[model samples]
Each structure stands twice: as structure tokens, then as C-alpha cells.
Target: MAKYLILIYGDERRWDAETEPERAAKGAAHEAFRRAAGEGLLGGHELEPASTATTLRSATGTAPTPTDGPFLETKEALGGYYVVEAPDLDAVLALAARLPELASGHGGVEVRPIVEHG
Candidate 1:
């Protein structure tokens, strides 16, 4: 089986402003998606708001510099991720197409295969 990382990106502003009921509904939807993924879902989790994120930059001769917030400022930021096991890219794409964020125009999913090293 091939391992893939499904990165979920969305507008952190919209996510943070969501009401309690809206958050609950989203949670329920994720639960349903988890069930649908079944054995293909190896692991996944929601992330803290992007405001809490920190970025690091390194120079060849100096220590890494730490900065608050994401590396890139955009309408959407990475919100969460799922590690999945699938037979092929088609299956993974099908799964990603069902993501709630995409349906709502919040953001979209990025599917990338995991590289194995030994």
C-alpha cells in the first residue's frame, strides 16, 4: 500500500469565527468522513488555529530565527492533515474530493505520496 499525506488547508479566520454549532457540525462531518475512509485512514487530526503557529528561518552561518505565524500569509493556511494508505492516486483523489472544506469553498486538499527510506 502507498502512504499519502492529505493536507487540509482553510481560512483560519473563518475557522476561528465559526459558532459552536457550526464547529460541532463540522466535527460530526469529520466523524462521518473518518468512517467512510475506513481502513484507508491511518491517522489524522485537526490543528490549532494558524495564529498560534511559529515559523523558523535558518541562515548558513547563523542560528535559526523564530517568528510568529505561518511562513506564508494567504487566505488559506494548513488546517490539518491525514495520513492514509491507498492503492493508488485515484483512490486518494476520490477521498480528497469528499472533504467538507472543498465543498464549502473554505479551501482544498493536497494529496502527496509519502517517500519511504531505509
Candidate 2:
């Protein structure tokens, strides 16, 4: 089985401004997605803190420089991810397409293969 990392993105501003019920509904949708995708899931995912982001850059012979925010300052940032196994890209897409509508337009989800570590 091939493993894929599904990264979920969205508008932080919009998410921050959502009502309690709307937030809860989106949470429920994510849970449902996890349950449905669990049949082929290799691992679970997480939701990152908005203010916890730190950026880094290459420093000249010293160390990687650290910055304050996400690598990109776009309204959309990586909100969460899922790791799942499938036979092929088509199977992966089928799962990726199942993401919630609220998660759409805000940003989007990205699917990529996982590199096996020794």
C-alpha cells in the first residue's frame, strides 16, 4: 500500500470568525472524514495552533534562521493533515474529494506521497 499525506488548508480569518455551532459542525465533518477514511488510514492527524507558527531560513554557516509566522502569509494556512494508505492516486483522490465544503474556497487540501524512512 502507498501512503499519502492529506494536508487540509483554510482561511484562518474566516475560521477565527466562525460561530460556535459552525465550528462544531466543521469539527464533526472532520471527525466523520477521519472515521470514513480510517478504513485505509495509517495514522491520525492534528489541528495546529494559529499562533504557534515559526518560520526558518538558511543562515550563512551559523544555523537556520527562525522567523515569526508561517512560511507563507496567505490567509490560508495548513490546518491539519491525515495519513492514509491506498493502491493508487485514484483511490487517494476519492478520499481527498470527501473533504468538507467549508474546507473548500477557504484554501484547499493537498495530497502527496510519503517517503519511507530507513
lDDT of 1 by residue, 1-118 (tens): 8999999998888888889998888888788878878998999988988889989999898999999988988998899999999899999898887778886668889999999896
lDDT of 2 by residue, 11-105 (tens): 77777788899878877887887787777887766676556888789858888989877776676778888899999989888888877744456
The lDDT of model 2 is 0.80
Off by over 4 Å in 2: 101-104
CA-RMSD of model 2? 2.1
- TM-score top scorer: 1
The whole-model C-alpha lDDT of candidate 1 against the native structure comes to 0.88
Instruction: Report the number of the highest-lDDT candidate.
Output: 1
The CA lDDT at 109 in model 2 is 84
Instruction: For each candidate in the order shown, give its overall lDDT on alpha carbons.
Output: 0.88, 0.80
